[model samples]
Target: GPQGPRHLRPLLDTVLDALHTGTHARGGPLPTGGPDTVTAAVHDAAGDLLPDRGDPDALRTLVHAFAAGAADPAHPLCAAHLHCPPLAVAAAADLAASALNPSLDSWDQAPAASALETLLTRTLARETGHTDGLVTTGGTEANQLALLLARETHGTVRLVHGANAHHSLPRAAWLLGLPDPVVVPAPAGTLDPVALDDALTRLPGPRGSVLVAATAGTTDTGLIDPLPDIAARCTAHGARLHIDAAYGGALLFSDHHRAKLTGLDAAHTITLDLHKLGWQPVPAGLLTVRDAHDLAALHHRTDYLNADDDTEAGLPDLLGRSLRTTRRPDVLKLAVTLKTLGRTGLGALVDQVCAHAREFADLVHDDPRFHLHDRPAISTVLFRPAHAPDPAVAAVRRHLLTTGRAVLGRARADGRLWLKATLLNPATRPDDLRALLTLVHRTHAEGPR
Candidate 1:
């Protein structure tokens, strides 16, 4: 009898090599000069060459290079839009979720994940004074689901949004197979209940079956629509009220901003993005409804999936309520983050970010070069060169990104291109923002010229 030959050499060598490799060095101020080369070097035989395929190490290196060149949201200087660098604890949770690979489609497959998701969704609904909801991939999906549910619940004829509502609202309407949404212009990114009444009044048919949407936080202007008045009108007109609080939902935890979302508790449905204001990892959005049965009309089941008998028995499944399949366990990240940072801490973080936004707005207002759109209600600061002509302002905005200067944003507002900044990081300070603004001005002044 012969013992099997030992083939442990490769494993041992790999472990030893990994140990010797050490860690990545702290590179000097990120090379704003860009990489020396953009193309992948395929000929290098440095490591992991697969005879039939390609060099694995080289492929990995090339991919890393590309990803590194992309925007690093976590960077101290990277503040562009709603996306922010996640907290370290949440990132760790995300890593754990990826490793566990929970699907949440069924209890048998993901019992803990399903339970946790249900609990988290319930908690969120309670926070908004709603009774039912589900986690979504982002604010867009949440808003879409809210509108879809509203359409089914009340048989609404028309969908309406304040002019300043996020683009996602109309996008949601189009996605739900509805006609172009009826948009009423807001005076200053804050929905006017009177304008909404007028829009409903002018509609071709009975406006009783309309869905009027009020934005809790308008993206560019960070303004909250008059939710109480809008709710009252929706009730009087027999219309359904939907609030898109994707950006301002975090303010629920803020004493000062809670009043802005005063009527949210009365809305038929509402959308919120934990990733935006919750400071949780991305893909943590939620849609809540006042009644659980409102979602029954959208209930669907396949023979291979849950049948009516199973659903009647209360078998746990999220597939029928969502548009996605084989979805990631986003709830784990959200729950873990929330558990680590209690509601109070989370609320404080949101308050800090909003305060910073106001501070930045004041700084911009004081500077003759920059202009403020309006006093920021949430964490967004939209501005452009004060008194600069439309073309010049547009050029400055375009140059900021093109020249590798501070990354700001541009939007067509009030018939002009307005450069905007959204404070995504709660840790960001006014001094850091001032530095970013300085970089933006320098680039705008010199780059395009």
Candidate 2:
């Protein structure tokens, strides 16, 4: 079981060398290859792996090659999604977590890791003004868990969310065997409270048992819904409110913008994704509930793992806190990040990125060739070229990606395709965004390829 440092030293050197090369020497955000090209390279790299073991040098070379091919989020032009360039310290913490490989199912398996998760979850809950919660894989799982708890508590109920809600909500409803959700329209990015009230009035029978899923930050427009109004409406209708703040929950850390999520504390449950805005790696989602009893719906005892008697005997188990059985303690990285950065440091980073989004929106508004969709509420600006056709808008995005110059986002707004820039990197400047827009204009002038 004892392994020598000689065995690990080479592996570490290989990985570090590859990482430096990939980050510093990469051509652009993405490599110049389509799916077929990359697929062929991957297949060739895997040749004779099972039948004949490859040399360490060859394997290391292949790993570096693959790393080089990945799209670089650290690139300023990689402003497509909520995919932020991970902090180096957080990445290092993640590597430690991977090496330790703590499975958070039982205390015996992960003693300190389980405790760390509890500590992190408790801190998150306090920040969101909740008593208890658990870490999840991402916003999808957090949303599903929130809806699942809502369904279990209220039995048969209809789901309600804005039209601009994430695609995962409908799927979550289906998975929970709930009826089709009543989608309230959000024309200007933010959900209209009048439209929501009208929709609630039109619902069949009593509205006493509805699951009102509110969006804190929409994906396309980065708008926070009218949380106070929505919360009041839910209370009036005797419905439970769940705020899906997967994108904008970082406002909790921002002193300037935390007011945007004012009514968040009133919600019955809230979903937050640290991966998006908290500057952590993927799979760091959190779901907090006002009433701890609501989580009892997901609880089940196991004979070998978390026996009922084990709890009575003073053995603390977290099986009931998760929908999963064998979950990794991804919370470790979050804990390390929070401790290293603190609230003010993280909040400043968020404020900086959001400022960049506003700056970009101003540029779009001032430019004659671009059309500003709306003033961004978060760090995402939705706009398109003034003269390009809807189809050409998508084409321009593809062209940018294919050329490996940029990796911009595309979305449909009001029956038309629009380009999006999710300014998640604090290091990105106004000049960088202006350069991106210039590229978009030049690409549009070339016409759709």
- Residues 233-344, candidate 1, lDDT per residue (tens digit)? 8877778788888888888887777777888998988899878777667778889989898878766677555666776898765666677667778888888878888878
Q: Which portions of model 2 miss their true places by more than 4 Å?
A: 1-9, 204-208
Stretches of candidate 1 off by over 4 Å are 1-51, 54-63, 204-208, 308-314
Q: Could you give candidate 2's per-residue lDDT for residues 221-283 as a string of tens digits?
A: 788999999999888877789999999999899999999999999999999998998878887
Model 1 TM-score on a 0 to 1 scale: 0.86
* The best candidate in terms of lDDT: 2
lDDT of each: 0.73, 0.86
lDDT (Cα, 0-100) at 122 in candidate 1: 88
Q: Which ten residues in a row have the lowest lDDT in candidate 2?
A: 1-10
Cα miss at 46, model 1 (Å)? 14
TM-scores, in order shown? 0.86, 0.96
- In the order shown, the candidates' Cα RMSDs to the true structure are 5.5, 1.8
